[model samples]
Target: MKNPKPTRQRERHNVYRRVREKIIGLDFSPGSAISENELAAALGVSRTPVREAMLLLTEEGLVEVFAKIGTFVSRVDPEQVAEAQFLREAVELASLRSLSTPLDEEKVDRLRDNLRRQKETGEDIRSFFALDEEFHRGLMDLAGHESSWSTVSAAKSHLDRARMLGIRKIPELGRLTEEHHAIFDAAVSGDAATAERHLRSHLRLVFADVKAVEEDSPELFVRDRDAGPHRRSAFVWD
Candidate 1:
């Protein structure tokens, strides 16, 4: 008999990935209500996989389960964002400092291509977002530490939400694309110092972005630094 464990595990992960993507993309906005039946129906899957997926997300602190209420998307927590940012910045900067003087021209070409697409992406936030991820991942690959991107990525759910908000709020999105160009040029020319400087600056900008977005959409963020699920409408309060 064929073992169903692998297939089941893959299906659960697939469901988790899709749901997590939607959450990060703000389709399931922070602090919003989620109906298991609706979500399962929307994804064209049975409730079992969806339930398992939400369980995984809850473990990741991305979803909250309120007894006698419902499951809710956890509000963006600045602390989590900061922690994730710290992890990403540390790994990326360390990689930058360890870069070889002469970067691979082929890798350089891929980064260039990503930047070109980013420039051409214009104000298409979602498309630009994907390109932005690709550009950064390309940088990691260029340093031959491509495996590090996954670890950086897995820890940055809140950061991703903040970035989505920031991308939406930025008046001139090209500014980020330009930063990518600066980092890429510096790296290709074997200028690790300049590359690291630009990369650090670029990565740190998320602090301001998170602040700006929180100001604009206060409801999308956590209520307080220390709060618990209240009797409120699927939200946590102190």
Candidate 2:
């Protein structure tokens, strides 16, 4: 005998995560249509849970619903991306500063292990991206502020989507991995100042990549802060 409430909640969350990943990974792409019926069929559930999941996404600013135009994957907002990046830097730099001169041996080893795995990922964008996230979150955990990672992650959905688009077009993974190594080296060497400098530079560089991406695909992003949903065809927008 299964409890219906838990099962329903689980199904709703399953749809939410799956759809969220697709949106962030650019599989759905910005301004693309999201068919509730299609997603329900694909996820092997009815429209009830799918609709529930979409309602939540709407609150996250990841989904947009029009009166007659239907729902769509929201466009990447550069302003939102910058705001998220600022929050991420402030939190992560604070964590680095709070770390003791001599870091925990176990945490240092784990950081090194994450870097090694990052190098091994080699062109697997999603895998590398996941590791990149884990590595940053690990830094917070190492500094005794693990719970703060959740707050940072919640605020970074827009930034994450922008990052996926940037990395997909730019061959920056190697450079990014090298930067991670540099940051980790400074952290373990007990040089908080150097570590903060490296991390600030690393976090700031994503905007450069994002700008290049925007230049290439103007339609995928919103330039003006007061912009609203512009209409387009059913299958594509231009």
Candidate 3:
């Protein structure tokens, strides 16, 4: 028997993308409640699709639904952010190591172009993050590990919010561009080990910067110091 395609599924996906962008851009800030009715109205869609999209986002850990309180953007957990960074570094370094001598020129150019766009974007954090993802994905593609790139991309969402906050305060635009240039040079020179090392260091450095922001901006963070030792553990990274 041929199964019928679900028409609303496409609409749900569109809604999800729109809402997810808002969440990542911090338009829907952490712990901010959003009503399904209001969202549907704003998106010019029915409630069914909005609900479906919200459910999908909730599964992705991007949104939280409280029974009585309503749905809200999930707060960034520092521990989750650290774990995501660890996963990204592990996959990225492994992919880099697998690359032999004589790196691909096309991939190198792609990364260079991404960095150029990143620099030209200036303080536009959303555009910068998109280019940053593309830059890393280009390296992963060069290593012939598209699936690995997908895995790392999925894990990076938690780190995205933290990164957005960190970059806003720290002005990492120039530093990030320099780091990418360094990694690009190492990769194109066929220095796999050096490239992997630089990539790992870059991930760790960003994590440290994010942690600093969490400490400095307590109000922006959802975790409260008065919440006890659990909160401390959440923020502490190995």
Candidate 4:
């Protein structure tokens, strides 16, 4: 039996993490082609590892490959974003309800801390978004549903670009902050129903904003006309 050392795993993990972050952070925008040769050269690694990393990203739905053309970052799909939002709400609500007790002082403090940073980082969309993600994941972690965070995180990748547009134009940042506070208070008081209600409302606002952007920026979103019947089912959202 060949035993894999921890360092080898860590190196591979770092490679994949960096590449995935670059893609999700919009360092590589949607439909932007990437060359494995260039990426491997830049990362100072062999094509073998970079190829593996690209494959992992593809599995996460962040990249698409064309047989003869090339590999490009996948485009955003409004319908998929809607579906992701639904799944996120269901998973998170279920997770919150299953919690036996209110969130601990540490978790509550962490959430408050994150919120403070979010407010102070006004107009810094990337930083604010990163903090926002941390806050929600922290809440889910408090509810002992860390694994669900992975699913939500993966789904949110498809929603990010649209969200970036929404966040830029939406003036509801303060309201959003208040919503977070409300959810935190409910969770701290062990009020599952209240927490779930606030959570759903918060997510609904995001969905509305994303839908608006999708309507306004048709080119950025997947179009019904361009999609086949089979693909249309996956791209149509109510």
Candidate 5:
């Protein structure tokens, strides 16, 4: 019989990424119970791999396990979101500072193209989110800080979720797109001070969004542990 090691490893990795994406994308819904048996069946894998993936997610603070209660997709933690926002802003602002006069025409054109695409996305929240990511990564690349963006992306899962929540609350993403344009304009003009200011303000906007969302849907966020357990039904909106 062929060794099952390679197959098992591949299954574990697939399950890990799939589960992580669902949680980060809010597919599973925050604070919702995650059933190991159901997930295993859905993935057509044994419980071992699913359980292993859950363990890794728990370590990442994306999932929580309560003794005898069950495993759950962890609620959005504003503190964690704030920390990610701070790191992202620092790195992006520093990147902006690295830019020199006479920005590359090719790179500037690329950013403009990205903005055009962002406008075309209209009210498609998921599409807008994807383009939003591409636009930021494009800026990092323009500033010769492409490698740093990977680090930022990996650490900003919480921030991404919060941004999504914000999108849901807001009427449209036009303001965010305009903010991107302002930052891009400053960068292309080689105005480091102006660029840094715009970028700083843009990055910090997530906190206000978080506050609005938390006030609207308090159940979707993490509450104090001492307050005791309260499991609210997960509500998924299209």
Candidate 6:
């Protein structure tokens, strides 16, 4: 039998993860052209994996590749955001309902730790973003349906940039932690109804966030889906 190497697959996935995070984190702004060769050079890999990764992202609606021009990060779609909101609210709220009386002490303590870390993140939006995700995933874990979080996470990618945009634009970072506390308290106190209400409200805040972010960076999302930004060279940031 011939020896098989798995590192190539891992390399491709690493490239994908890095690129996807950059996209979701808004490091690569919407509509910014992404060059495969440039990405390969930056990641210390060859273009093959970079190209493959971009293809995978294309299937996920995160990247757009035109026939001749180039590949670029897709802009935030309002429809996608709305749909993602609906799905996320459904999953998180249902998870809340699934919580039995007397939430697990360990998970509750972990959530407390998450909230404390969230408070300490201060103005570091990236750290706060990661913690925000962890808090919600913790909720799912408490409900004993931790496996479902992967589905929610995958479906919520389109919604992330707008959420990230909202976080980055708003100077007061503690507001999110406050909201997390509300959800956590309601869940742990055996008030599933209130927890559901709080979680729904928190998830739907993205709509207002979308509006605000659109006002500040109109180019990040087209007001109308039919209209599109003119393709520019990868070097253009504006």
lDDT of 3 by residue, 105-156 (tens): 7777888888788779887777777888888889888888877888777677
Provide the lDDT at 112 for model 4. Answer: 83
Which candidate number maximizes TM-score? 6
Deviating ranges (above 4 Å) for candidate 1: 1-10, 67-69, 225-238
Task: Provide the lDDT at 198 for model 3.
Answer: 83
Model 4 whole-model lDDT (C-alpha atoms): 0.76
lDDT by residue for model 1 (164-200), tens: 9987888577888888899888888888999999999
Pairs with backbone N, CA or C atoms under 3 Å apart (clashes), candidate 6:
none
The C-alpha RMSD in Å for every predicted model, in order, reads 4.8, 4.2, 6.8, 6.5, 5.1, 4.2
Clashing pairs in 3: none
TM-score for all predictions? 0.86, 0.86, 0.85, 0.84, 0.83, 0.87
Candidate 5's C-alpha runs over 4 A off are 1-10, 67-69, 101-107, 226-238
- lDDT, candidate 5, 1-238, per-residue tens: 2556554578888999998878878888887877777788888999999999999888778888877677888888888888888889889888899987666788889899999998888899988888899999989988888889988987877778888888888855999999999998888877889988988888878568877788787777878855444455353322
Local accuracy of candidate 2 as per-residue lDDT tens digits, 94-181: 9999998556788778888999999999899999999999899889888988789988897888889888889998766989999999
Model 2 gets an lDDT of 0.85
Clashing pairs in 5: none
- Point out the higher-scoring one by lDDT: 2 or 5: 2
Work out candidate 4's RMSD over C-alphas: 6.5
lDDT by residue (109-218, candidate 6, tens digit) is 99999999998886888888899899999999999988798888877788888888887778677777888999999888888899889888887775677667767877
The candidate scoring highest on lDDT is 2
User: What do the candidate models score in CA lDDT, each in turn?
Assistant: 0.83, 0.85, 0.79, 0.76, 0.82, 0.83
> What clash pairs does model 4 have?
none
